[model samples]
Target: MVTPAGTLALLHTSPVHVPVFDGLRDRYHPGLVLRHLVDEELLRRARSSGSDAVAGPVAAALAAAVADGADAVLCTCSTIGGTAERQAGALGVPVLRVDRPMAAEAARYRRVVVVAALRSTLEPTVSLIAEESGPEPSFVSTVVVEGAWELFEAGDRDGYLDAVAASVDRAPLSEDSVVVLAQASMADAVERMSTRRPVLASPRLGLAAAAEAVAASAAVRAGRD
Candidate 1:
């Protein structure tokens, strides 16, 4: 479907997230229109250097998504999410980072174990958790699920998810620790995990926030009308 005005634009680094978010919209927010914008280069560039390397493009992408008639932009890339949200002053419309809600939830716990398939995602997700957790955040542990990203790159999706779930399950954590799936691709691993700790993923939480943003924007527009 065309991305009509007032639609929630999803900015993703990987094409894999399109169906994931679309499914979320279908099940939870059926009335919410979604537009998926995938730019693998943004993530590829960030992986090569760092999040700083892709800040300009990330900001540009958020602006472009809004320019294309998005009422709100939900950036699905945790690596560049901070950059996208920092543009709130200029973007005018709401820009939601998918991981923020997850991060906020992670803050409430005494310890947060962040899991991801890619090495590049560890720092960004961990740092965001701390930033949201206030002046003194919880002790954060990171587990980079080895070989999982390679499986994903090789199109072994099930293998990738299996590796992720297995790695998180195998990680040593206190029963009270909160587990956070740092990447959107790894969200589904929750169902596969045997870990007793609370696990949080961004897809559903992020999209729900975007749905609210869309509603608030519509409300404002109606008042203006």
Candidate 2:
């Protein structure tokens, strides 16, 4: 697949993500052209079955993006992120896990808190933190905010944000601990919190990394040509 320069395709599991990621692209990577492909069923399957069950869909999405002339692909759903990255190499384009950069940042802190609205995201997020943290171990705690996803699904954005924020506030976080919002949608909630601890959110960091990856891929291809 011959991808055009400065083109980024995001494979999202929900249509709700299009605006969120499009906004991030506009703010962080304004020069790059952004495209979105949504599969609403992917997340439901991932949550109910497993990430491996959605591997085929993830690979298909990546291939479709590359076929559509995307220089790189971003998997916006953390639930399917591992599968997307695993298949990235075969697609001939960068496929980035949205929480990777946030995981890297969280790994730097001695104590870390990972908060998620879905149970499926916890393991992948913790695994990413472990991978990024290297040989050294960090104290990582996880919190799954109850009712947050329901509120989000019901279109009660404020209710969802409040639930997440309240969960973060109730977490056993120290002043030195860094909090990580495990899902991109939780970013807004973290921003609204009054905690003194540093909070890491995936969207901005992930998109920045995606932009860099795309630019590097473009440069490499240009040199090769």
lDDT of 2 by residue, 55-79 (tens): 8878887898899888888888898
Worst 10 residues of 2 by lDDT: 1-10
lDDT of 2 at 197: 83
CA RMSD, predictions in order:
2.8, 3.0
> Quick one: best lDDT, which candidate?
2
Clashes of 1: 0
Deviation from native of the Cα of residue 68 in model 1, angstroms: 2.0
Name the top TM-score candidate.
Answer: 2
lDDT of 1 by residue, 39-88 (tens): 99998998898878888888888788888877889999888888788887
